[model samples]
Target: MKKYIVVALLCLTGLVQAQEALFSGQQVSSPQVNDDKTVTFRLSAPQADTVQVTGDFLPSVKVDTPMGKVDGPGKALLTKNEEGVWSFTTSVLAPELYSYAFIVDGFKTTDPANPFLIRDVASVTNIFIVSGKQADLYRVQDVPHGTVASRWYDAKTLGFDRKISIYTPPGYESSTAEYPVLYLLHGAGGDEEAWLSLGRTAQIMDNLIAQGKAEPMIVVMPNGNVGQDAAPGAGSDGYYTPQFMTPETMNGKYEAQFKDIISFVESNYRIKADKAHRAIAGLSMGGYHSLHISRYYPNTFDYVGLFSAAIMAREDKSGAGVYDNFEETLETQKDNGYQLYWIAIGKTDFLYEANEEYRAMLDKMDMPYEYTESEGGHIWRNWRVYLSEFVPLLFED
Candidate 1:
């Protein structure tokens, strides 16, 4: 028994040493942000024939898509060394959060050395931040941060307990203040968690409030897809791949059922609960929802923002719920009075023409609004910039 025990101990010791050596031997520090504001990415794939890096930091090349010419991600080939290690260094990158992946001999993969990553719809990419003025608010600073909670609310209209992400100000838990509410919606293929994760809503809010650039308000993000109970894997469907479009997206169901979300928010949380103190904004499909919801239920949102929004009216306009009374609704919303109606879109956005038509309609009605056009297309980068700029303009009263 003593001899057997000694042998087992020796084997265990060898196994541990092997693991340690294996890790230490192949370990190469990737994503080395150098002193000159450049980034170095290294991958140890000696067996691979070719390796290349692709990221948003690279020069964007215009690609022809169905939505006109949109800027697509660019790639750069990495040089290999004697040790079979492939590496590529980027030129001075601006201070911003960038996502990248490695294409190894035609197969796309992420850096094994870097674990930090983010998911947009079905695609997952590794991310790193070049810290500077552009990304100052993207990181978690030493300032007081707000609490973000994934609360399950009763959606009576949808007949289910829907998931909603809420961001309360830093002192919300401790203070008795009734603050204004901002309903922040995500684009198609996004869920309640989209704004918090991709949009960096909490970080932006915390930094802005800490700097006294924006008012402290509660931000609510809800899943706009009425068919799905929650986000992709978060709903009754388990671990299913996320798609760009889901059932009941633009069929006027979500807009009609949106009141349940508002009701749940008002009843449960301490809010101003009035039109003057309420704001609504979204990107892409969510922007479509925002435009319709704000106008459909006139006087509900005093502040309305459409960020790269899809502005075309439904083809089936038989004067039914939500889609019914389009111009009449806008006129009512205009007459009911609003503090701000902000419309923002990218110059190359596919929906740019649609937005132009919508703006023309608004102009024809002599409706008051603030129009801001940016450079870029239907992408998250512009959306983030919009959010950073938009929140400061909300609830100044």
Candidate 2:
């Protein structure tokens, strides 16, 4: 007992020392936003021989004339000053959220000074938002904020308890209103937390609702990984890394399991619970899931959105029988009379050709859909923009 007590005391003392060491320094301003809209990034790695900063702020180049632009991994070298600080200033960046990292002595790491960070699958990086004019839509304004909850529900189809992230509009608790629901999905390697943290879904919805651009609604973000019940470390089943390359993770399990999510939402929330009031949208793999789910479950969702969707012409068993009886399914969906079918992708996105092919197919079938072509490649920036645009058009009649 005495030995155990001494060991605990020593561990406590070491922890205190470590905490002090973390903050013992002259505070340096990092990721400093300048009046000119340029950003200054700084790091105090005195021992590092070389330091470089890389981020989304760097413009992507057009590799092929027709293929669109692609962002290559690039970095800007920072200059070390006499104060043992390495720093770099970026050119004036457009208003948007950007993720960045530092490459010091051949190792990449997040900025030590920045507390705001986002975890994307296996990696984590620091993030900053540039705000003004049109970009303000992605920014958090002084509007009435919505409430976001991380909750779990039983997925009888999957035979396990699953987790989801939900956003209820402001006044939802007090008001006796039956609201509309938007089922938002994350891309490959993402889970329920993706939209809440990286996509800024709450802020976008709140801003739009405050401006009367979008109706007050309940947003549902569900984990798309079938093998995993929730985001990594959030479930008792243990942390399962999303296997994007394998059929086990990409299989139609989630598509078949989607109904469970809807049932849970309808039962728990005061929602309209009708085809016209229900909407579905997603990005990347989530977009693919949305396409399949809306296709198979015709007449269930009146509005559907696909952002940088991973579309293919061939049928695959992994995707819940996607492209199986494709014509018949679409015809049935069209006949069911959806309010809106929207597809948006970046001009430089690698999926640009696939989107064009899908558009051609839609044209061949005489089905109607609103197509939006924006600037940028397959990225979260475009996904956020697409959501803001798509939400305002929902349930508009």
Candidate 3:
């Protein structure tokens, strides 16, 4: 009994020591949002030769890559203090959600002090929001929030069970009325969770509905990659690295199987299952899907949105599937269109010229569409703005 008592005392003493060490005053607090609207990032790298911080909030620099010249996040060197701490303070930054990373001795890494993080493609970085007019809708405000559910449905067309993310509006649970559905799609290297996590879909929808800016509607987000069941680590092929371009992407496979998603959504949810109450929109590769899917079904979706879309015809014009017979299908879609067709792209986006050509084609065909041109290139910032603008215009009487 005495031996057991001694062992227990030793274990308790070790635990208390660990607690004290964890709670010690040596903790580093990073990404301090100052009152002056400037932000400070700190790292306690005592033996590091050099330290630097790079983020989207800073001015971008043009960097040349194998793909081409592109705008990259700017890096700021951190000054070392007498205590071996390295830190950097930025100037007054615009109100927005920003992501950043630290470079310690040329090694890119996340901030250990910052618990909040988001992954885009394969890169993971810490994120922070600067509260202001533009960023307010992105934050979770004191409003009636909606319910987001991860659902599994059998994709009979693809011969597999797929995962989807659904967002029902604030009053969907108690309300007996059927609601319109907006099918939201993500860009390349993104999954169904892209809009929920990175695009701030819930916050935007909740705030918009609470303020009476948008009508209550259901949102369906499904994985566009036909070869994958879900995002990395979330699928049966567990723990694989996510790539920018996955298999079966933009090969007309996903577009052909899209009806499976709609069929599932309509069958399971209390949705107004008609062309008038349905809408589809996406960014980048998703934009390509939206464009093709809306046209392939002709009289299906009344509203179609393409944000920073890849607008080009495929090499095979043999009228095989969604990619083939593009002009003919688009013309048919235009003739059968019931409501709005929205197209938006950034001025600096690589797809700008292609969008201009598509718009010209539309002009030739006398197809009507609302166009919005933003300042930045292909990015989440512009996509979020496009989504916020497009939702308000949807399901309007």
Candidate-wise lDDT, in order: 0.88, 0.86, 0.89
Each candidate's TM vs. the true structure?
Answer: 0.93, 0.90, 0.93
- The reply for model 3, stretches above 4 Å from the true place, is 1-26, 63-68, 315-320
| Candidate 2 local Cα displacement, residue 392, angstroms | 0.8
| Residue 218 in candidate 1, Cα distance off native in Å | 0.4
lDDT score for candidate 1 against the true structure:
0.88
Extract clashing residue pairs from model 2. none
lDDT of 3 by residue, 1-397 (tens): 9999999999999999999756542487789999888999999888899999998888877777433565678999999999887989999988888999999999999998898999998989999988897788899999999999999989887799999999999989998989999999999899989999889999999999999999999999999888889889999999989988886667777887888899999999999999999999999888988998898899999999999998774543223466767789888998886699999999988788889999999999898999999988877888888989999999999
Which tens-of-lDDT digit does each residue in 255-366 have in candidate 2?
7778999999999999998999999999988898899889879989999999999775333544456557877998999999998999999987889888999999999999
Indicate which candidate wins on lDDT.
3
CA error at residue 284 for candidate 3, angstroms: 0.5
Candidate 1 TM-score, true structure as reference: 0.93
lDDT of 1 by residue, 109-223 (tens): 9888888988888878998888888588888999998999888988887678888899999999999999999999999888888888888899999999999999999999999
